[model samples]
Target chain A: MKIVTCIKQTFDTEAKIVVGGDGQISDEGVNMILNPYDEYAVEEAIKTKEKDGGEVVVVTVGGDKAQEALRYSLAMGADRAVLINDPALEKADSHAVSVALAKLLSDKEAGYDVIFAGKEAVDDGAAQVPSRLAAKLDLALANVVVAVELADGKATVTREIDGGTEELEMALPALISAQKGLNEVRYPSLPGIMKAKRKPLDVVSLADLGLSAEDVASKVEMVSAELPPARKAGQKLTGEVDEVVAKLVELLKNEAKVI
Target chain B: MSIVVCAEQRDGKLSKVTFEALSEGKRLAAASGETLKALVIGSGVAACADELKKYGADEIAVADNEALAAYTTETYAAVLAAYIAQESPALVLMGHSTVGRELAARAAGIADCGLVSDCVAIESADGDYLFKHPVYAGKAIGTFKISGATRLATLRPNVFAIEESDGAGAVVDFAPEIPAAKVTVKAVNKVSGDRPELTEADIICSGGRGLGGPEGFKLIEDLADSLGAAVGSSRAAVDAGWREHAAQVGQTGKVVSPNLYIASGISGAIQHLAGMGTSKYIVGINKDGEANIFNVADYGIEGDLNKIIPALVEKLKEA
Candidate 1:
């Protein structure tokens, strides 16, 4: 088995997001980490490689800073990592990113049995890349997958739907987006971190993939970015429990008209 | 050009968000002077076309096929992309659902169009559409414009209102050339619950670690039942094994914007707030007065959830 997992670096889930004056999200003084959901993808890929005896290659598309994410994946047991860094990708949308990834994965020399990615990136929360990539490559895809098993050149995956779970079986060379409840991710050990420093990390650009900036240009443009309006604290009920409950119900029905 | 709404159905019944999307599609089409078309794809979803007509879909297209009985990325995307290729609609709309999130992107990719996911608002300025969506896990909002002939988007559930209007309800039989199945469905385990789905529910009652254990969910469920709300859980509760991951409402879980969100015993971590801060109204019940949940809540009740939840349930039942 040869596995490829796509990962991204995003702001910490708890980071307070601020939009700068230039209509861009300011990453200054913000903590960046591996996207929480992508951690599950990396962990699942490593586990599959450990059990099935294969090479796990992690890939990402971003600027030089994204090398940190690749290094982190390397520490987590990915055999090697590829960072598709390019200045033209600064304003890239999900489509542009997917185009670049499809190009990288389409290389016949680096053929793969399975591809994994986080269900969605926390920063943009687009959740579009993996499906788009799979479509561009004309491969089977399963999103929000929580369980996966492999046998006989095929993969069985259990994914979350609206009201329940669905079990799916796809042939080799399929793509899956990892959802939560998939697996418990392991923290990198000291030895693992040391070994990662020496692991092979390749940095490529759009030109290197035989593509120009125009070819992978973003179809969507961000007009503005701003923080959500602040919510003010409302009435606090601290009186007797029974009276408060009644008052709350009355408020909900009469004032809020929610009930 | 026309505006197309992809209506989703399960067991021949249209999802509530489908109606919402139809309503939005009608408004967009009226604004653009374009036709409003609704597409229903499934094994026995021809009946859904009637429902779409009632909700103001001028043209209802049904792609009834056994191959589309269950959603597979390859088959559904193939059908949708083929439809887009044939119709060449200016805009495509669907619910920001599990299926919609995957299907829209795949279809957009196959059709080589632009897609914006989880849109909360859409505005037209100078004949251009601007999509407003949350970024950084709902902490910030980004206004975007798609630079393409065909633009696709998924509207977040509950953010758009549903309005009924009679249309010509013209039926169009669509023949889709579905590709050979690359993925096969083995089984489906549908959760047996009478409560409304959390994402589509107008009212949601959520519990947290403060409730102590799994037994505490009984109180939450009772409250949810009395108010006809869906049951939700904070990540702590789910992590503690008191609830299913599907019930979790947080950064790593489902993001919901219900009309009313009642959170009990939840401390409202930033991640948790990211999932539900956009709700129209938030009610927090906690023993600690300084829990973060109170900051964003419209109504804060400082008391033990054990006492407040049950009392609220009884009061709601009487009302």
Candidate 2:
């Protein structure tokens, strides 16, 4: 059973986003880190490998800068890292990226038992690539999984819904997207970080995967970037709690009519 | 050219978002002089065709079967992919929901198509469509164009308006050849509560770290029940373990745009605002008058929420 995990390099969640004069976002002076959600996938992959006596490999689709993200996963106990860095793939939409990933991993011929990824990339919030990749690879897919139980080539997964949970059972060679609370992500030990520097990290391109530019071209083209409309300030209602509630209810009934 | 609107259902009832998708599909189709068709899939859902017809659907395609009663990723995606491959519609649209997010991606893969998810707005010009969606956590917006022959996108709930019109009300049956499902749904653990889903709620009442502890949620729950609103929480409350992460509203959590949003004891962090800023009306209540939440709130009240919430709950009950 070989475990492959997908990771992404994204701007820190708390970083202040700046728009450039080119009408695009400015990543300058912003910290880049592995997507937080993917951290859970990395942890789960390592734990599964430890329990099942297999190897964990981390894969990513981004530019040269994404190598550091893969390194972070390698330090977390993965045995190998693969980076898909092609200028043509920059800022590619989910559809294009997933296709490239499916092609790259399947070409490995490893017969992977499980592929893991963050449910949604925090930067784009697309949340589509894993499922699309599953379709491309013709594997069973489950997203936002909080719990997973593996036994005898079968995987039982529990996904979180709005008000409850949905449990599903699937065969091996499946894809499971990680959500928060799946497991506690462990920091790399000093020795593990040193060992990661020598681990095998391979960089592949469109040519390497035997794919043409048009075959993996992004159908979704980004047009422009803009900020949302700013909210306006409103009057403050000053009074006791009781008076405030009374005034709010009055406003709701007569002014807004939402009640 | 035709636009296929995938109608979603649960427990033999159509989702409200299905109508919203149909309405938008109709408008887009009219702009391009194309046909607008509704595809309703489920068991015993033939009656949904009449409702879709009222929503301006030129034709309705029904795929009713026992195997389609519950949503399975493989079964649903296979069925939809086969339909798309056969009909070759110019565009496919569905709600950006749990099922839609998973199904759209899988279906796109099966057909080797393209998709843009969580679209806030859609526009058509000269047979080409543009989708507006938030990137970088609502700090910036990205407008996308799909040049492929077949395009797919999922619309955010509550963003598109629902419009009704009279149509031919024609019904067509579509039999999808479903392959053996690789996955099986064991059970769905439903939380027994009358509250609406947070993402789909028209009104929301949220709490934050100011609530102090888990017991403080009683105030929010009571007010929410009184107003018939869903309960939400800032990431602070969820991180503090005072509330479940499912109730969290922030950049990493669910993005919701409701008609009215009441924030009790929650300071307006940019991440939290990114989720709920699109709400039509916002009311902020906190002990500090200088909280950033007041900046975007339509109305601000300076006080402790523990006191204000109980008072508001009582008032709402009386109303």
Q: Which docking class does model 2 fall in?
A: medium
Model 1: per-residue Cα lDDT over B1-319, one tens digit each? 8889998888898899999999998888778888899999889887788778888888999999988888787888888999899999889999999999899999988988889899999986666799999998888999999988889999999999899987788999998788988999899898838989899999999999999999999999899989889999999999999998999997889999999999999999999998999999999999989899999999999998898888888888787
lDDT by residue for model 1 (A1-259), tens? 8999999999988788878989988999998899988999999999999999999999999988888989999999999999898999998899999999999999732589999999999999999999999999999888999999988898999999998999999888999999999999999999999999999999998889999999898999888998889888889977899999998998899989999
Predicted complex 1: CAPRI docking category:
high
Q: C-alpha displacement of B184 in model 2, angstroms?
A: 0.7
Candidate 1 C-alpha error for residue B111, in Å:
0.9
Q: Per-residue CA lDDT of candidate 2, range A1-259, in tens?
A: 7999999999998887777887778889989999999999999999999999889999999988888889989999999999988888886888888888988878863589999999998888888899999998989988999899887999999998756789999999999999887888999999999999999999988899988878778878777778888899787898877888899888877887778
Lowest summed lDDT across 10 adjacent residues in model 2 chain B is found at B9-18
- Positional deviation of B212 in candidate 2, in angstroms? 1.1
Which number leads on lDDT?
1
- Highest DockQ scorer: 1
